[model samples]
Target: MTVDPEYASALADGLTIPHYVWGKQVDPLGEIDNITYILLAKDQEEMRLRLLGSATQTMSIILVIVIFVSSTLSTAWRVFRQPRSVVNWCTFVQSSSATMAFGFGITMKLSTACNCRWAIWTASLGQAISGICASIVLVWKAYLAYDRDRRFVWAGIILNLPEPLYLYAAWMHSRTTFTPLGGCTMLYPSWLPWARFGMDGPFNVIFSAAFIVVAARQYRKHGSAVWGSLRNEGTIGLLILTFSNIFCLLLTATNFADEYSMMFWGVDWLITNQILIHQHRPMRRSLHESGRARGRNRNARRHDAETLFHPQPMSPSDKFAQWAELNLLQPKSNSPLASVLEAPEPDISDIGHTPAPNTASHLHSTQASTGYW
Candidate 1:
């Protein structure tokens, strides 16, 4: 852990880091001038931030990739089998955004004085593209939810029209520095954090509001039975996106450019993509038909229906496989496995037969029906 005198001197003279500090200790501050000691301390802090940022960003990237891969694989066959232009384009943009984020993160982590400018420009362009694409995807979902309402769609389009130019302007005013730790850091104007909030906050609000309105309409049409429909519709994923966006906004506003900041980058796109995949899963769409029927029978109290239907609820893994069957298997009509692989339709014959009192079986039945949202 011996410190190198020449390296230390060069660092104190404000030169770029020549090498990484691998378990090497800083020389005693007693032998250095006050200015050198201060510089060393500052560099130590910057190095800590750099290493932490790299680690967290790596984890974020890994998680995003896993989500993308699993979601894409699950939907790949279906996407091809039933080609919808909206979903197709959405998948493309999600892939593009994830790629840009991956590249931008790698460049930031591996940046040096030699590539500092490259990192800066990459960051500016890559991040702008990623963010704007994510926003567009979100707005498109809202537009579809609103039944392609012109006003809502046009508002979203116009609001986001300035995103590229705004980002370009912000990057122009931003300052970049090469850290003594051999990483690049960008210092943006205070308005940048709020700019991010402004860019994303409205879309999230609009999308969430539109989703809730749709849910409410379903509820009015189906009553308490709408739970199953909601579950099958990826309500949980929607809520996750809503809360995560709010949390990230809070962090960016209060602690801008801190360790927590970069970790959330591209998360919205990842989660949104997952939701889209989940919604389009074949099992979910089939479930939705029964979901409405279940809602329709909500008023006729069938307290023991759940107990009779699901004496023992399926386990999580079993439930997942059941849900995943459509993605994994397409039973050949002539094969023996066809009968085995095919799921039995739920017998809603007894759904409203008896006007029994409400009971916990209702809750159990609800959980058993959808498993989890």
Candidate 2:
């Protein structure tokens, strides 16, 4: 087999990706940037062992953080007011999967930099777990959007029901199908990796199309007749969210298809983060509004209670209050007709006679004295 020194050197020179080592599973002195170097498995198993130990440490740290975040979010949902029902659950799945992805990255996928057979096994486990969660969330999100809108045409209620089940089966396959392909991966049994890629595409198409279709229909049906801008904004946000997720999840299929030998999980990272924390902006806005609301609520009640109980004269030093009142309240006009019009017109029958239009001005003069204006 060809040595990887040129590749490692090229990469190191191009980007600053950190490196670690596992067992003899990876080429160490591969081309870091553009220059070739030694350090293949034949060079030194001792160095490989050291890299493995360090990688294991890194994986452990990431795994711990993932567990903490997942548990904390779960507990928060159970005890406190959940941010949302479906969206929150989807988020939990995404977060857990992400943690697992990171664990896998540090373990088997990046094994060249940090190789260990045990770490490889652990990484595989983490990746499988993440995949299973992703499958479930995908199915859930699709159904949630469709059912909420009550949109479908002859599609079965459990149309995408096979998603989670297929994912579980795929995870099982990964266990039985692993190989020593210089690292831990389900690329063994050859059929398994392709199978995974196969499942992801159909799964993504079903759910993504479902959501996109439903959202479009909803916008078309309601957007036209409804003059409410809030509806439009909400519908538009849903579209943005749906399309972004579709593009993100679609990568799983791409990975399976081997479009790129190198997997970039960053898109997946940002996608799940955006999805789960969909309400992040809304939550932030609510917090800001709540502060103002609390103050307003307190002021409103105080104003009411004070008027009913204290009935004190306005303080002259309260310039703000005075200025606010002046700005908020319209001032009365200093003209006679303006004052007269401000008063309620007397009932024509109360006079018991019809008045001449010429005397209308004289009748108005009496009303201003009562200060109804």
Worst 10 residues of 2 by lDDT: 29-38
**Candidate 2 lDDT, tens digit per residue, 1-373?**
4444524532443433334332232323221211111122223664465346434444544655565366437634633454444445555665665555555445433334433333434444544445444455545545555543333322333444444554444334322111112123233234443454454445545654555454456446555322223234434544554455455445544554342211323443344354435423243232232222322455568889999998877786786778877754544577665577688877777575765676666567766766665
User: Candidate 2: which stretches are off by over 4 Å?
Assistant: 1-41, 44-84, 104-125, 135-141, 147-187, 222-341, 344-373
TM-score each candidate.
0.53, 0.43
Q: Can you write out model 1's per-residue Cα lDDT over 226-344, one digit (the tens) per residue? A: 43466445466667766776776666556554634433445555655666555544333433542433222432346467667768878999988987786456666667787766769
Q: What CA root-mean-square deviation does each model show from the true structure?
A: 21.9, 13.1
- Taken over the whole model, the C-alpha lDDT of each candidate is 0.54, 0.44
Candidate 2 lDDT (Cα, 0 to 1): 0.44
